[model samples]
Target: MSADPTLQVSVLLPVYNAGRYLPEALESILAQENICFECVAVDDGSTDDTADILNDFARRDARLRVLSRPNTGIVGALNDGLALCRAPYIARMDADDIARPARLARQAAYLDTHADCVGVGSWVDYLDPEGEHIWTWKMSANPAQIEHDLLEGGIGGLVHPAMMLRADAIRAVGGYQAECKDIEDYDLFLRLLEQGHFSVLPEPLLGYRQHPASINATSNRGARTAIANRLMAEARQQRGLPEKVLTPTPATPESSQLEWIDLALLDGNWRSARKTTCRLFRSVPLKTAPWQALGKLIQAALGKLRIRAGRIRQFVSIF
Candidate 1:
């Protein structure tokens, strides 16, 4: 399809079973100001109300274009959406994340002035499932630093959903790679870095939601780490640099127990959380880093307190 001469940006939103957060995500895009854009929302065979929501939104707004297909994972959904994008710039978005109103405007403006930059991302306010602010995730704005980090097997300031990519530059790199899977964004950023310099806006422009149902939470961490290590090795080899010995961090039983405890707290299962915490505490003495275990336990307790306090505030506000 030919590029739309009138549109300045194309919001590429690939959605799965994200019915709970889809409306907010769509509203964020539709509500963006000072930028002419089209939202190409691809529904990857969502069994939930995702398709219905998309259809209703599309009927109300012409800019939101809905495309439905079989469940083909994120990489396939992204590439397919990439093909349908009608603007020179493609802004990536997730169905569960909320973009700030000025996100598209500022990003589009930055790209307009920085001709050397092939892609740009911004810092994001990390949000919990209930839309509560967790913390601001800051990314380095320096291209040199970003490249260095990528070479060292880090993400290099390119937060996937918070990025605005040059359509041509992304296409040149062949979009998202299927082999990369869970680490697809990291791989794409590495390849995109070769085409032109990447930049990051220092300010937070998106609300990045982290929940149990998120891909990162559900994916195999070991496999992702292995893929990332391999990509870094390949990148170093291409640059004629010495290969760094990278090892995937092994998941300890204590860490798994802590995660369960955290989830239990989130779900208001105090009894289960107490039981798991006790088990974890017992196992900690056998481990090498006793202090680290204690620190983690304290952190988990603090998180639980925060969640409870937030719920209390919400309940109070209701009256």
Candidate 2:
């Protein structure tokens, strides 16, 4: 370990209604190894006992610092924390998630080795409140791969709770944007990509908690998708891409696959549906590997085309 004080890192965690799991989350950070860091916990006017929990923890540990303020939502809270951060590097941790013991150490090591890499995350194992492992999402090990994947989806592809980056780099990109507040991490990653590469550790170093009240679980997916589509449009404009490319086309050759899969299944075209389903199964691996594959196979077997034309006509006539 380098005995350099300038390498100190600041861990910023913005708290909302996170009373249920805040203690465990805080404990995870306190247990981190091989890193000299400060923990900044900002309470975003949580109506729950979140503030009380933060106070109790702050009293116990000198390393843990707490900021209590009115709720301005996550984006505001994060930006506030960002402005207050004094360390050279900043890491993000959600109040409801658990960071593996090596989370900080690993991220700090990577940033130290590759000074050009602005940000780094790691593969994560999703867990429920009781700490049961539900699924895993792998992330990009190379920053270039992350950027390419972002064009298709979001770079830092599947972001985890344990993310570390250069504070200055984030500031340079104008911090986080409110327009993309809901998808702030993705937006920040895009901006960071312009400055330097962002990569993730191959091994799972973060245990992300998935609860009913979590942002991803509670937010409307349709609305988020719409917002993401808009961001893509704006991003194209920023990059000077053609107007045609800037506008989201009506399902490209890539999306056509999904359309065909739906049509095949509805038309009871088992062969076609099976082939398309197989293509999807091969392309994307689900978290529940066995269950998802089995369900897809069953759907392929019972393709909608299996229904007789006469029965369909009779049902339609009755309606």
Candidate 3:
């Protein structure tokens, strides 16, 4: 239930030096159609005008409220925001990302109907630095798919920012823990999966900005890998899964490079995508999926239309 009769979701937007993109992010939330939600934006000790920007927006729109505190990183901001949520559901957002207009309405409707699911996410449209590279990420659409894919070490088959979770399910796990900093969202998703059903929609509901200076960009990779591995192992054990770590199947560099092509296409960098496609074809010409993907990439390059480019990415890979 909401503190206000109109509220159906509480958007948790944590900011830290994201002054440049905060307004567009907030505008996206405020423009949401047929969605009654309150944005609980935490400044998280930003040294830039991030706080002032949030405060200005809050004054203009009652739906958005700003909070400021020390720069304790995303984990602290998430925990604080969770405690302040008045709605039955919580939706995650970032200062630098833009949410789709119907994101909250669709996710809210999904959670309201799917009682067994503790949380749900949607595939996100990834944006490159120049914003020309627009691509969509595919995530597991149901609990069964996620259960099978969770064995992989990266991304964990879920796009964190596009997610909305049940209030009770989040509280059950005591919210985001401090030590799980880099991989907290992944860790919590696993825990929630164990507790109840979780799923994702096929639609690209959020625009995730990719830049070099984001927090995850600078995280200690070794430390994050260690924590993610430990958390996944623990979750598997809790679910009575086998102990052996699953090799992501087909361990070739081409397999890895194919992922790069996906990113290149997403960033709308056809030159990179085309080059990577050629390399993959030369290396693994017999791979049928690569062949299909490469054909699409070539077609995308010839067209040079953003819509076609976006459409081409939908078939980038099966992984």
Each candidate: RMSD: 8.8, 11.7, 8.7
Q: 219-265, model 1: which lDDT tens digit per residue?
A: 67788888898899989999998988566655554555455555555
The residue pairs found clashing in candidate 2 are 267-305, 268-304, 268-305
Ranking by lDDT: 1, 3, 2
In every candidate, how many clashes are there?
0, 3, 2
Model 1's alpha-carbon lDDT is 0.86
lDDT tens per residue, model 2, 167-200 = 8898888988877767888777767777888788
Clashes of 2: 3
lDDT of each: 0.86, 0.73, 0.78
List clashing residue pairs in candidate 3: 133-267, 133-268
Give TM-scores for every candidate, taking all chains together and pairing residue i with residue i.
0.81, 0.73, 0.78
lDDT of 3 by residue, 1-319 (tens): 2355567999988888988888889999999989889999998999999988998999999989888999998899989888888888899998788898999999999999999988888988776444434456777686877766765555545777888999878999889989999789888887777568778888989988865455455556667777877877887777688775433233244444555567777666776566656665776789864686676686666777777777778768544
